[model samples]
Target: MRPSTDIDPAIPLRARDGDVEAFAELVEFFHVRCLRYARYMLGEEEDAEEAVQDTFVRVYDHLGQFRPDARFEPWLFRILANRCRTVRERRRRRESLVTTGELPAVAAEAEGMSQDLLEEVEAALEELPAEQREAFLLRHVEDLSYEDMAVITGVRLSALRMRVKRACDTLRIRLKEER
Candidate 1:
């Protein structure tokens, strides 16, 4: 059965029931959005792309268990976030193992292209802790509400609010320092 919001309700239900065509339709609908979220969270383009693909696989495996009443995007996002966390943990382990090495460089053109406003915002966002960064990106960049963020991050609404607030404060401080 298609979710009510979907243009074609039958497709999702069919997909949920193991129809390949219906599943493919769902993939086409959500793929780009998932990739954008992955990119914003992971920061590495290649890693982000991998994360998106991983998310799709997980979603496919678990889709049969999804509640019909629940919204689809949050379920997908939870998978994405879990994948991102795994990638980040692996990176941390590698970082601890490595000796000193040249850090990844931002392209000169990227830096030159950014105005002060953009630079300050980007710098401040980079300063946030991972959870807070995810909260901020979901809330502002992706335009998700606090409730949706709570679902996506598997946090309570109050905790999501706090994370977003902390992210904002950190951004403000970093931006002020840049001025």
Candidate 2:
């Protein structure tokens, strides 16, 4: 679940230069990770898929604006995060009063955990405040550095660290309560 370190440095440059094949390669490389992030954020498969599609479309359209000196992964994630927020806002507006008790299933399975423990973890994650959840996921799940997270989320570094710390504290308390 770490941020990919093997991304080709030339791919973003080629993509910016309007190389369709290069863009396709970027999509192929990033799609799964993007989908995973979107799903984790949005908590629904359909919404995640839509958000990722919209993210790619926006990426293609705005490729010209990408700065050559900047890292592409953070820039791409920024767009995807924005797309997820937009989708979430739209869903909130559309369904103002949803009352479902069913929790959104976690997409990733823990290798050595029992099903009950996994459920507890997923529920604990779901209970986090949205900002905390995003910060925690970007830091622990995606394994991005605080600087990279700040770049992607536009939050100050100290604030991001506080959010992540709060998230971890909340998760620990919640998981212990579950046990």
The candidate maximizing lDDT is 2
Candidate 1 accuracy as lDDT = 0.73
Error of 1 at 52 (Å): 0.7
Model 1 RMSD, rounded to 1 decimal: 6.3
Q: After superposition, how far is residue 47 of candidate 1 from its true place, in Å?
A: 0.9
Candidate 1 lDDT by residue in tens digits, 13-107 = 67778988878888898777677677656666677778988888888888788777777767777888889988877765432221122323364
lDDT scores of the candidates, listed in order = 0.73, 0.82
* Model 1 lDDT at residue 120: 57
Q: List candidate 1 stretches off by more than 4 Å.
A: 1-11, 93-116
Reference-based TM-score of each model: 0.76, 0.86
TM-score result, candidate 1:
0.76
What residue runs in model 2 are displaced by over 4 Å at the alpha carbon?
1-6, 93-110
